[model samples]
Target chain A: MITSAAPALSRVHDVTEEVFAAIREVRDATVAALAPERPLVADLAALRPLLWSRLTTGPLAALIAGIGFIAAPGLLADAPWYLEWWQQHPSGQPRQLLRDLDPASSAFYDYTHWEWFTGPRVGRERTICGPYVDYLCTDEYSLTLSVPVTVGGAFAGAAAADVFVRNFEAAVAPALRELPKPAFLINAEGRVVASNSARWLSGSVYRGGLAVTPVPGLDLSLVQGPAAE
Target chain B: MVSSGARLAVFSPVDSTARVEAVVRRLADAIVLGLLTDGEQLPSEAELAARLGVSTVTLREALMALRQRGLVETRRGRGGGSFVRVPPDSGLEGRLRGLTVAELRDVSDHYAAIAGAAARLAAGRSLPSDLAPLRRSLDEMAGCPSPRLDGRFHIEVAAASQSARLTQEEIRLQADIGPLLWLSRDTPEGQDEMAKQHQAIVEAIERGDGDQARLVAERHVLDATDHLIELRLRLQD
Candidate 1:
C-alpha cells in the first residue's frame, strides 16, 4: 500500500542483483540438468540429488531449503518428478532426500492453482510463489523461486528452489543489527522476509509507511521508519 | 501450551436480547481469526445457547446475524447444523479493502496493542522451547499462501506468553485486523521490510529480552498506525 518508496538506494540494488544472479544460476543449472536426460520430460525421478547438490554448492546454500521440478500434468504421475528437501534428521548433519508426494493429495489441491506454479505460467518467466506455507507438501514457510523448465521449447513444468524464511532472517539479522532505525525487506506479496527493527520484522506483513524504497530488479522493497530529525 | 478447550474462558454468555451486537461481534471475531476452522461445526444449538449464557432466542438471532454476514451457514436435515461458511475471514481482504482509512487505522490500533503486549509477555514468560514456534511460524509466513496463517503468527506468539487473556485477545485481533491488512495489498518491498522486523523480534524474544521485545512490539504497531494515518491523509488530499 505504501508506494511512496520508489526504487532507490544503490546497496539495495546491489543486494537485489546479487540475489537474482544466484537464482538465475539455480534456474540455468536446472534447465541444463534437464537437457541431457534423453526423454527430458519423462519422469525425472532419478535427478533429485543432482539438482539439490548443484544448487546448494554455492554461497546461497544456507538460504535454500528445497529444490525440485513440479512437472506438468500427466508428466510426472501428478506429482513432482524429483523433489529434494533438506533434512537434518540426526542432529544438524543436513542431508538431501527426495520428497514423496502422493498423487491423491496433489490432485486434491491442484498445483497449477498455486502461486509458484501460476506465476511462472502466466509470466512466462521465473517467479516467486509465496512467503507462504506449502501447508501440505513442505509444511514450512518458504519463498519459492521457480522458473519454467522447457525442453524443445515446450513447457515441462517449473524448476524451483525454496529459501527457508528462518534462514533468510538469520543470515541477514547480524548485518542490520547496527542500524539505528527500523528497516526491513518485503516480498512481492507484501510479506516481510527480514528486518532490522521489530516494527516490520520478518514473518509479518508491511502495510505501508515512511522511507519506503524498492529493492531494484527484485519483486521486493526496502523501507525505514521516519527520520528522527 | 496449546489448549483447545481454553477459549470458553473469554466468552461471556449473553443473557439479554439487547446485547446482540456484542454477541455477534465476539463470535464474529472468533470466526475471522480462525479460532474456528473452515467447515468446523459449532456446538449444538442448545449447548451453545447455554454456553453463551443466552436464551435460545437470542442465540438464534445471533446466528441469523452471522449468517447475514456470510460468516456462518445453517443447513436443515441430518448431519447439518451451523457450519462455518467463511472459515476465519476467508474473504477478509476483499471485505477489508472496502473500509475507509479511518476504520482501518482503528482496527490496526486495536490489533497492535493486543499483539505488542502478547509479544512482550511471551518474551517475559516463555521457555526456549515455547518460543521455538516463532521460527516455524515465520517459515510458514514466508510461504504462507493465505492471510489466516499469517495472522495466526501473532496469535501463536500470544499463546506462548502463557497468558490466556493476551492469547484470547490476540485471536480476536488476528481475525479482525491481521488478515484484513493484506486486503489492501502491501508492496513486495514493504513485505521484505516487515520480514526483517519479524526476525528482529523473534531473536529478541528467543534471547528472553522482554523490554526489547515490548519496545519492538510497540513500534511495530505504532508504525502500522502511522501508515493508516498517512493513507487517510492521502484520501483526503
Candidate 2:
C-alpha cells in the first residue's frame, strides 16, 4: 500500500461501511421486535412494512435487493425456523418471500446451514459472506451482510441484507479507479469483491502478493499497487 | 418450473450483441418454463427496458417477435400491457428436429463441460444445505414429469459451485437447448432414470466426492444427448 493512496482507499472503505451500517440497522430492529418474547408468525409478519420502508429509503438503497430475519430452529412459536424476508420487485413493490420449511420436503430452505446465518451464530460477530451468485434472493452476483440477533444472550436468529455485486461495483469502482496503481477489494476468503482493473474478476481467488492495508472493521482488505499475478 | 433465482438471472442485463434475439429467447424461456405465469401482466416498456439494460427500440423488436410467436398478447386501453400467453406444448419435437445432428452434438459437448465442471466444483465448495434445490428438482421430476425439471436441476448445481460465471453460462445453455434435451423426460421411465442420475449427482456432492460428481454429471448429459439424437433420427425417417 502506498502512503498517498490512503485517501482513495478510505473512500472505498466508506462505501463498504455504508452497506454494513444499513444491515446493522435492520439487525437492530429485528432484535427489538423479538426482545420481549418469541413472536408468533403474524407478529413477525407485522414488522414487514416498517423494515421495507427503511430498506428502500435508507442510504445505498439502490444497491440493496432485500433485507430480513431468519430465525434459529425452535425460536419461533409457530414454526421451527422462519424467514421474515422481503425482496424488491422490478415494479418497485416489495414482496414477502416464502419457502417450504418442512424438514421432509425437498424444497425446505435450511438457512441455518448457510454461511451468512452460521457465521454470525458461531462467531457472534457481524459477517460479510459473498460475491458469489446468490441463486436465492437475487440471482445476480451478491454479498450478504449479517448479524446475530440475540435475546438475553441466547441465540435467536440472524438479520441479513442482500446487496447486488453489480451495484456495489458501480458505487465502489470509481473510488478504486482513482488510485495510481491497480487495486481491488477482497473478503476474508481472499475472493475478489471488486476491482479497478479487469485483471481481478469477482469471485476469483487473489493469490498475488498482498498489501498490508485493511479496510477499517471489515474482514476485507484493500490491495493497492502491484504484485506478481 | 424455473426457480425464482433463475428467472431473475434471465432478466439481468444482456452483455452480448444480438440484443433483440437475446431478449426474445429469455422471455420465451420464462414463459415456457412457467416462470412467467399465464395471463400475468408484464411491466411497462420503459421499466422493463431499464431492468434489462436494453434500449426501448430493441425491446420493441423483441416484443414484436414474442407477439408473433403467440407467447405474448398486447391489449389496448385500460390495464393495457403485454400479458403472457403460454402455448400448450410449444412444438418440442419440431424444435428438436430443427437442429442438425452436428449442431446437437456441439451443444451437448458445451453443456457437458459446464455441467461437469460445476458439479465437481460444487462437490468441493458447497455446503450441505446447497443441495436442497437439486433434490427438489429431482422430487418434482419424479412426482410430475416436466421438461424444465432437469434444466432447473443443472442450474441449481451450477449455482452451488459458487461461481457466478459458471452459473450464467448454465442459464444461457439451458435457454438455448434445455427444452430439446429434456424432451425425453416427459415419459415416466425417462423421468425415473433422470431422477436417479440427478440423485447420484446430489449424493456425490453431499459426500464431497468431486470425481464421482463430475463423472455422473457428464454421463447424464451424454445419455440425454444420445436419447435426443435417436429421437431426431426417428423423426427424420
Candidate 3:
C-alpha cells in the first residue's frame, strides 16, 4: 500500500529483505556443503546443523520456525524425504510429546504443488511462498521462503524456511494501515494480501482505482484507490 | 509460595480418571518426582479425596497400591496418615538403564516442543515480575543442578509464559522425565554444560528476545537428548 509513512513501509521492506537473505544463505550453504560427487539424496541430519545454526544464530532468528530441504522424487528409495528439518523447539518450549508420523503412510498433501517447492524447481529463482496454511509443517498459517539448491546445474532440491503467518502479517500490516487513501497489497492475481482500509478484505479482489506500486523486496504490488465506476 | 505452575498442576480436577488406577499413578508420580516427599504425611483421607477429586474408597485403594509398591507407609492412630517412602534409587536406575535410544529421542523431541514454545511465549508475555522466578531457578540450578531444580528451571520458563495449560502440561512432562534425565547428567561436565545452556535461555527471556529464547531452549533440549542417546549407546558397547 502507498503509505506516506516511509519508515513503516521501509520496516516492511527491511524484514522482507532479511528473510529472503536467510533463504539465499541456506541455498548457498547447502550447495557448498553437498559436494557434486556426493549422491543427490541429502543427509538431513548432516544438513540440519547448518540450517539450525543459520536460522537460530543471527538477528532475524525469531522470525523463522524451521528450515530444510524438500527433494524431487526418486532421489532416495524408501526415504521419501531428501532432507527435512523442523526447528528443534517450535513454540518456544521443549516439546515433551511428539506425534508419530508414519513414514510409510504418505499422509501429506503433495509438496510438489506448493509454490515454495515448484516455483524454484521451475524458474530456479528464490521464492517467497506463503502467509497460507502450511498443512505440511507447523499446521499453522505460515510462509515458506525458499531458494533452489543446485549441484552442477542440476536441481537437487529446494532449501526452505518456515515463518508463521501471524508474524509475517504483523511485520507488514501496521505499515499498510498508515495509508490515507484506500490502498491494498495485492498478489499477482489481484487478490488482496492486506489493506489499509476495510473496503477490501485480505484475499478479496481490490475492485478500486489506480496507482499501483510494488513494495520493495516483496512480490505483492500495492494498489491505491478510488473505485472505478 | 507455590510456583504458578505448581498451583495449576498440583490442584487439578481429576474427575475423569478410571478411579483407583489413575489416583495410584498420579500419587506415585508425585512421590517419585518429590512433589510428595518422604516422611511428609498426606492430607486426611477425606481432605485428600476432595483435593484429588476422587472418592475416599478410590483414594484408599490407591494408598493400598502405593503401600504395596513400597512408595507409601500408612500408620494408624493419632498423627497418623499416609506417608511417602522415597522411591528406590535402584529401581529408578534399573528403569533408566533399560531404556532404548529411540525412547530417549522421543522424550527429547517432545520436551523441545513444550519448552521451546514456553520460552517463545514467555518472551512476549512475561512481565519483569515473571522474570524473577526464572532467575531464581537459574541460581538454584547453578548451585546444584539436581533433577528437581533443573526440571523446575524449565518449568519456570513455561510458567513465565503465563499459559496455565502449557505450564500444567510441562509439569506433567517434567515430573515424568525430569528425574530420569539426571541419570545422564550425573557427570560434572554434563552438569556444568547444562547450566550454561539454561543460563542462555534465561537471559534471552529476561531481555525479551523471543527468538533467542526459543532457539536456545530448543537447542538445550535437543542437546540433552543427544547426550542421553550417546550414553545409552556407549553402555551397549
The per-model DockQ list reads 0.01, 0.12, 0.01
For residue B185, model 2's alpha carbon misses the true position, in angstroms, by: 10
Best by DockQ: 2
Whose lDDT is greatest here?
2
lDDT pick, better of 1 and 2: 2
Point out where model 3 deviates above 4 Å.
A1-9, A36-42, A54-58, A76-78, A88-104, A207-210, A226-229, B1-237
Q: Count the clashes in each prediction.
A: 46, 0, 27
Model 2, C-alpha of B73: deviation from truth (Å): 31
Candidate 3: tens digits of C-alpha lDDT, residues B1-237: 323332333244543336687677657656655667779988899877755545687788888888898888988899887888886652444456778778888889888899899898777655544566568668766775667567656766876665555777777777667766765666888888888888888788878899999999899888777777776777632
Given candidate 1, what's the lDDT at residue B183?
Answer: 34
Each model's lDDT: 0.59, 0.75, 0.66
Best by TM-score: 2
lDDT per residue for candidate 1 within A46-86, as digits (tens), equals 54444444344456556665666666664543233434334
| Ten-residue region with minimum lDDT total, candidate 1 chain A | A99-108
Fraction of native contacts under 8 Å reproduced by each candidate? 0.00, 0.16, 0.00
Error of 1 at A129 (Å): 3.0
lDDT of 2 by residue, B35-98 (tens): 6888999999986775554678888999999999999999999979999997765555656766
Residue A218 in candidate 3 has what lDDT?
65
Candidate 2: segments with Cα more than 4 A from true spot: A1-3, A35-38, A225-229, B1-153, B160-219, B227-237
Model 1 Cα shift for residue A147 (angstroms): 1.9
